[model samples]
Structures are given as C-alpha cells and as structure tokens.
Target: MEIKIDDLQGSGIIRLLEEHLADMHATSPAESVHALDVKALQHPSITFWSAAEGNSVLGCVALKSLSCDHGEIKSMRTSGAARNRGVATKLLNHLIADAKSRGFKQLSLETGTQAFFSAAHGLYAKHGFVDCEPFGDYQPDPNSKFMTLVLEQ
Candidate 1:
C-alpha cells in the first residue's frame, strides 16, 4: 500500500474518517469524544495521511502538532476490509517515523477505556508506548486512557 499525505477530499477517505468519528462517539460519551471531524483534521496543526492500494483506502492516520517538539496521534483507523492486514500497524509506524523525522521528542494519544479499544491499547504498547497522565488540555477522566511514546532521536 502507498502511504502519503492526503488532501481529505476523496470519497473513500472521507467515508473512512466519518466512520471513525461515528465509532468514537458510539463508544464514548459525547463530551469525551476527542476524535476530530473532517474540518478539524484539516486544521493547520494537523497533518493527515491515508494508506491506499489502487484507489482503495486501506486506512488513515493523522499527526497533530501540539508543540514544536511534541505531537498527538489522531484519527488512527483501518478500514473494516483491511483489518488484521497490518494496515493499522503500517499507519502507526509511518506516523511514528514521520514524527521522528520532524524532530518531535514525544508522541501521545488518547483512547477509550472500553473493551472496544483493547486492540488499540495492545497496538500502542507493542510500539513501546506507556501509560501516562493526561497531557495538553486533557483532564482526568475515568473513561479515557492516555499513552505516550518518548521518541529517542
């Protein structure tokens, strides 16, 4: 699959992101859903990417610049058809490498505490991320689990 920066205008990717937002809301309280919508993902601080294999969007991920040396992983989703095919893994590895290249000292993310997010917890753990206290503008919440990876340059 070819992984590259996306313009976020294509139907396949738009649909994928919509589905991602839907799932996030369904699994978490409305006030707790931090997943960005299409417009939010298009903000200047965020860089969005989509993985595609010949027009089929395999997955997508985004990196939001939280500061000069820190970033937050956002919108990590693998298409249903691409699940278990290493799509999420590839997207995450790509995002991490991009963060490293950009001289980011750390990368962080927030996922739900529900069982629906267990796979995401495992994936982040496998990449050396560890549990962390709320960072940025986040506050303590029982429904949210935060993780961070300190990029070793």
Candidate 2:
C-alpha cells in the first residue's frame, strides 16, 4: 500500500471522510461530535493523507497543527474491507514519523467514549497513546475520551 498526502478533493477520499463523520455522529451526541467535514479538513493547518493499494483507497488520516510543538490527529478512518489489515497502524506510524520530522512534541486525539469506539481506544493504546485530559479547545465531555502520545526527538 502507498500513503500519500492528499488535498481532500478526490471523490474517494471525500466519500470515506463523509462516512467517518457520519459514524462519529451516529455514535456520539451532536455536542460531542468533533469530526471535521471535507472543507474543515482542507484547512491550511491540517495535512491529510490517504492509504491506497494501487487504485483502491484502504484508509485515510490527518494531522492538524495545534501549536508549534503540539499537533492533533484527525479523521482517521479505514474502509470496512480494510479493517484488521493494519491500515490504521501503518497510517498512524506514518503520521508519528511525520510529526516528529515537523518538530511536533506531542500528538493528541479525541474519540468517543462509547463502546463503538473501544476498538479505536485499543488501537491508540497499542501505539503508545495514553488517556489524557482534554487538550486544545476541548472541554470535559462525558462522551469524549482524549488520548495523547508524547513524541521523542
């Protein structure tokens, strides 16, 4: 599989992001949903990437700059057919390496607290992320769980 930086304009990538946002809303309350739409993902502060095998998109992930030393992981999604195939793991490792190269000291993310997100929690935990207090503009929300990974230089 190949992973490449994306501009959020391709139809396949957009469709996957739409599905991701929809799943977030379906699993979390409207007040707790933080997934960004296509336009939001295209912000200058964010870098989006897609993982594909030739012409088939397997997954996608994004990194959003929060500060000079901190960044946030956003919009991580793997196609249903691609789950359990290490797609997320590969993309996450890529983002972590990229983050370090870009001088980010930490990477954080917000996900749902419900059972629907348990798999995600495990995935992050497996990658060395630990539970943390809300960062950035986030506040304490029962439906939201925050995780952070402190990157080493």
Candidate 3:
C-alpha cells in the first residue's frame, strides 16, 4: 500500500471522507462525533494522508497539531472492501511516525464507546495507547472514549 499526502479536491478521496463522516454520524451521538469534513481537514494545522493502491483509495488518516509537543489523530477510516487487510493499521502507523518525526511528545484520539468502535480501540491499544481524559476542545461525553500514547522520542 502506498501512503501519500492527499489533495482534498480529489473526488475519490473526497468520497471516502464523506462516507466516513456519514458512517460516524449515523453510529455515534452528536457530541461524540468528531470526524472532520473536507473543509476542516484542509486546515493548515492538519496533515492528511490517503492509503491507496493505484487509483483506489484504501484508507486514510490525519494528524492535527494541538501543540508543539502534542498531536491528535483524526478522520481515520478504512474502506469497507479493504477491511481486515491491515489498511487502518498502516495508516495509523504512518501518522504516528509522522508525529514523532515532527517532534511530538504525545498522540491522542477520541473514539466511540460503542461496540462499533471496538476494533478501533483495540488497534490503538496494540500501539501502546492508554485510556485518558478528554483533551483539547473535547469535554467529557458518555458516548466517547479518549486514549493517548506518549512518544519515547
């Protein structure tokens, strides 16, 4: 799989993002929904990437700078057809490596508390992320679960 910085204007990537956002909103509560739309993902503080095989988009992830030493994971999603093939894992690993390269000391994320998010939560845990309180603009919401990983570098 090739992971490349994404141009939000691309129709394929845009469609994947739109589908991800819609799935999140449909399964998660209003306050627990944190997936960003194309406009928001294009913010200067966020770096977005897409995992693709030729012309097909397999998955995507984004890193949003929260501070000089901190970053938040955002908009992580793997295409339905690409599930169980380690696509999300690769995208996440790429984001984590990018954060470390940028001198970030911590990486955080927010996911749902429902069973729908179990695989995601497990994936994060496998990468050393531990449950934590809400960070940044987030407030405690019963429907959400927060996790963070402290970078060794």
The model with the greatest lDDT is: 1
Model 3, TM vs. native = 0.98
Encode model 3's per-residue lDDT on 61-109: one tens digit a residue. Answer: 9999999999999999999989999998999989999999999999999
- The global Cα lDDT (0 to 1) of model 2 is 0.94
Q: Give the per-residue Cα lDDT of candidate 1 at 90.
A: 93
Name the Cα RMSD for model 2: 0.7
Window of ten residues with lowest summed lDDT in model 3 = 23-32
Q: lDDT tens digits, residues 1-153, model 1?
A: 999999999999999999999999999999899999899999999999999999899999999999999999999999999999999999999999999999999999999999999999999999999999999999989999999999999
Q: Which parts of model 1 have CA positions greater than 4 angstroms off?
A: none
Clashes of 1: 0
TM-score order of candidates, top first:
1, 2, 3
* Clash numbers, per candidate: 0, 0, 0
Count clashing residue pairs in model 3. 0
In the range 1-153, model 2's lDDT, one tens digit per residue, is 999999777888888988998898888889999999999988999999999997788999999999999999999999998999999999999999999999999999999999999989999999999999999999999999999999999
Better of 1 and 3 by lDDT: 1
**What overall lDDT, based on C-alpha atoms, would model 3 receive against the true structure?**
0.94
